[model samples]
Target: MPATEFQQSSSSSSSSSSPSFGFSILSRRRDQVHSHSMESPPAGLENELEAFQRQVADRFHDLSAADSGELLSIPWLRKLLDAFLCCHEEFRAILFNNQPYLNKPPLERQISDFFERSVKALDVCNAIRDGIEQMRQWQKPLEIVLCALDNQRSIGEGQIRRAKKALIDLTIGMLDEKESSTALAHRNRSFGRNNLHKEHKSLGHFRSLSWSVSRNWSAARQLQAISNNLVAPRSNEILSTNGLNLAVFTMSYVLLFVMWALVAAIPCQDRGLQTHFAISKQFLWAGPILSLHERILEESKKRARRNACGLLKEIYEIEQCARHLNELVDNTQLPLPEEKERELRITVEEAGNVCKSLKDGLDPLERQVREVFRRIVRNRTQGLDSTGGGD
Candidate 1:
C-alpha cells in the first residue's frame, strides 16, 4: 500500500471508533421517525416532508461549502477506502497463493460488480437527461397549440358577430326605402332642370328598386310555406298575418309606394315602361327576411362549433401533458447517499488529476520530439554543406 493509504487507514481506524463519524442530519431524522409514531400523522406529513427536503438541501450546501479534498478525506470516507484496500490485498494474496478462483473474497467480486454497475447507471442517467430534454421541448408545442386554439376561438366569435351585423344591415336596409326615396326626391327638386341627367338616373334607380321589391314580394309568398320552419314550430303564432309577417309586408308596400312617388316626381318621361314599373312594384319588399338571418346564424354556428370543438380538444391535450409533468415533479426523489456522493466527487477529481498529468506528460514528449527533429535537420544541413564544399 502507498504511504498515504496507510496513513488514511490508520487515521480512519482511530476516527471510526467515535460515535459521530458518519452521523448526519438525515440520521437524526431517521431516529425521529422511529421515536415518534409508527406512521406519520396525515396532518403533519406535508410539514415533515418539507423539513426533510430542507435538511437535505442544507446538508448538501454544507458539503459543497467545505474544501473539496477535505470533504472526500473525511473519517467515514477513509474507512471505506481502507475496507476496499484490505479486500483487494486479500484477493491478490489468494491469487498469488494456489487458491481456487472460487475462493476469491466477496468484496473483490462486489468491487468488480460495482465498476460495471456504476458505468451502466451513468449511461442510463444520461439517457434520462435526454428524455427529460425531449419532454421539456414538448411543453412549447403544447403552449403553441393552446395559443392557436385561443386565436381560433377569438376569430370564430368575431365571425359570429360579423354575420349577425350583416343580417341586421340587410334587415335595416330593406326597412329604409321610404327615407331613401324622400332623400332622392329632395335632391332631384333641388338640382331641377340643370341636372336633368341626374333626374333621369334617379328615375332609373327607382325603377330598379321597384323591380327588386316586386321579386322579393313574390319570394315572400313562397316563404309563407316555410315560415314556420324558419321561425320555430312552437312559435307558429309569430309568423301570423297580425304579427312580424304583417309588419314586414307593410314595409314592403311602403317601399313600393316610395318607389312610385319617386317615379311620379321625376320630370323625365318614361319610354312606355310605366306598365312594367307598376307590375314590378306590385310584389316589391314583402318576404320573411328572418329566413336570411336564420340561414346566416346557422352557418356561423356550424363554423363556431367546429372551431370550438377543435380548440377544446387541443386544450385538453395540453392540460393532460402539463398535469403529467407536474405529477412527475411532485413524485420524483433524488436521494443524497453521502458515502456514494463523496466517492463520486473524489472520483471526478481524480479523473481531472489524471487528465492534467497526461497533459503535463505530453508537454515533455512534445519537447523531446521537437529536439530530435531539430538535431536531424541540423545534421542533414551540415552534410549537405560538406558535400557542396567537397564538390
Candidate 2:
C-alpha cells in the first residue's frame, strides 16, 4: 500500500458515497432559442389573431340598425313615388290630349286644355285603357328619359310638371278602375281580339325591360345601402349560451326590420284613413295619364327633345317603379318584411290599391286587364278588326 494508491482508494470511496443527477452532455446555453417545437404553426399566430380581433372590433362599430341609428327606414318613400306618378301624368296631358296617342305632336293649347279639364276629369275605365296605352308607349319614354338623365341637366321643371300631370292623370284612371266596379267590369269585357293583338308584344316587351331595370335599381339600392349604411348587416356577436355560440347580433336585424316594416306598412300618421281612401279613389287616374305621357315621350323623342326629354325619363322611371313592385311580388323570402309590405302597398296604391275592396284575389281581374291591353295594341297597330263579328 503506497501513498498514491491509498489516495486513489479514498477518491473511489467518496464517489460511491454520493447520489448523482444524470450526466449533462451540454452546457447551459445563454443564447438558446426556446421553441414550442411540438406545436404546429407556432405561437406567433397569436399576434395575427390579435390583429384580426381588432379589425372585427372596427367593423362592428360601423354597422347600421344598431342602438346608434344611422338611417331611418324609408317610411315616406311613397312621397317620392307619388311625386313621380304625378309628374308622369302631367307630362302625358301636356303631350297628347289634343289628338289620339298615335297622332303627331299636338299644339301647346291642345296640350294645355288636356291638362286643365278632360285630363283632370277622366274616369277610371278610360284611365285603365290609357294606362295600357301608356305602357305601350313606355318604351320610347324610357329611352328618352335615360338619354336625358345621362346629360348635364337631367331634370327640368317644365318637363317635371308635364310628367307630374301624366302621373296625376294615370293615377286618377287607375283609382277609377280599382274603385269603380262598373269600370273594371267594362275593362274586362273590352279587350277583344283586336285590342289583344296590339297589346301582347308591346306590353310584354316594356314590362320585361322595366322588370330588368327594376332589378338593376334594386341591386343598386342594396349596394348604396351597403355604402350609405342605410340598412346595414350587423356583425355576428357570438357569446356562449347553453354550450353554443348563440348569435346575439341577429336580433338587431330582426328588430330593426320589424320596426321598418311596421312604419312602412302602417299608414303615415299625418295621412289618415280618409287621405288613403281619397288617394286610392284616384287610382284609375294613372291609366290615362300614363298613356298620354308614353305617347308624348315617344313623339318627343323624335320631336320635342328638350321638354319631352323629361317625359322620356319618366317613362323609364315608371318602368323602374313597376319593376320594383313586380320584384316585390316575385320575392319569396320568408316573413315578408315591413319594408316590402309597405312598398307593395305603395305600388298597388299607385295603380290605386283596390285590393282592399276585393273578396279573394286580384288575379281574375288582372287577367281581364291584360286581355284588354292586348286588344288595345292590336287596334292601334294592326287594325282593330272585331274578329269580323263579336265575342
Candidate 3:
C-alpha cells in the first residue's frame, strides 16, 4: 500500500490490458511431439523448456542492464519472478515467509529460491566467477559474466539503504503470500538511497572539522583527522574510501605485510582464515579461484547441465581477463630501486630473469587451461544434447 507500489500496481494493471503487453517479440514456434514419446513435460503437456532458456537469458541480460535490483519491477522480470513465486504457491509459500524468519536476507533468499526452483541451477555462475578470478589472480579474464557492478560502486562509500517497511509490505503480495523479493528490493532501493543522503551530512561535518582553513599550516593540522583511522587500524576494511589503489590496500593489510616495514602487535583472526581461503580459492589468480568454475561443474552436475550457456559466458570472461593480465605483465619491464644505487645492477638482472620465467610459465599454463575449457565445453554441450530439446 505504499504510494509508489500503489501507483505501480495500478499502472501495471492498466498496462497489462493493453495490446502491446499481450504481444510477443518472437513468433511462437510449434514443436511436433512424437506420440510414442508422450510422457509429457514435467508439469504438463507443455513444450520443452529449452526455448524458454533464451527468453530467460534475454530478460536476465535486460535485468542486468536495468540493474534496478527489483525482480518484479520490470515487465519481463516479473514473468520470471512469478514463474518461481507462483509456481507452487501453496507448498512454496513458506519458502519466502519463513526465510525472513530464518534470518536470511530476504533478497538473497529469493535469489536462492530462483536457483533452487527454476531449472535447478548448476554451480556454474559461481564457478565462472571463481575461475575468472583465479585466472585474474595469475593475470585477469576472456573475461565474462561481468554485468558491470561498477555502476553500483559509483553510489559511493556511505551508501544508504531504505525500504525496510516497503520491502516487508511487498513481501505480503496479491495472493495470501503474494509479494516477492523482487518487489521488496524495488520498494526498498529508494529508502536505501535516502540513507545515503543522511551519511553525507556526517561526512560533511567531519570534512569541515578536518579541512578547515587554518594558519597553523602544520603536519599535525594536515593529518589530525586522518591520524586516528591510521593509528588504531581496522584491517578488515581495506577497500574503504574512494580511489584506494591495489598497492596501498595490500601494504596496509596482512597479506602484503612482508612488503611493508610495520611490526604488528596483533595477529589476524584465525576465523578470517576461511574467508581468505575462499577469496584465494574462488577469487585469487592461478590457484583455487581460477579452478572454481571447473570444480563446480565437476562437483555439482545438476546445475552444470541446466546452466551450460551462461556457464560458457562466464568462462569466456575469466579467460579474457587472464590473457590481458598476462600480456600486460609480459610486456612491462621492471624498474630498479633508485635508493639502492650500488645493488642496482644485480637486482635488475635478478628481476628480469624471474619475470621471464613467470611469463614463460604462464603462456603454456594459459594454453593448458584453454584445452581444459574446450573439454568442458564439449562435455556440457553433449549433456545438453542428451537432455534433448528444440530440433
- Which predicted model would earn the best lDDT? 1
Error of 1 at 309 (Å): 26
In Å, residue 6's CA in model 3 sits off its true spot by 58
The whole-model lDDT of each prediction reads 0.27, 0.26, 0.24
TM-score of 2: 0.18
Per-residue accuracy of model 2 over 1-391 as CA lDDT, tens digit each: 1000111121212232332112111111112443533112223332322222222222222221122111111212222222223333333222222122212122222222222222111221133233334334433433332333223223344443333333222222222211343432243333334433443344344333222122222221222222222221111111001100111112112212222222222211111111010111111121222332233334434442322112222333343443444355342354456676566456545432221222122233334434433432332222112111111
TM-score of 3: 0.19
> Residue 173, candidate 1: how far off, in angstroms?
53
Model 3, range 225-266, lDDT digits (tens) per residue? Answer: 211222111221111211011111211121111101000100
User: For candidate 1, what is the lDDT?
Assistant: 0.27
Expressed as tens digits, the lDDT of each residue in 96-141 for candidate 1 is 3322221233323322332233222222222222322222333333
Give the better candidate number (1 or 2) by lDDT: 1
What ranking emerges by lDDT with the best candidate at the front? Answer: 1, 2, 3
Models 1 onward score TM values of 0.17, 0.18, 0.19
Q: RMSD to native for every prediction?
A: 44.4, 33.6, 28.7
Off by over 4 Å in 1: 1-107, 149-391
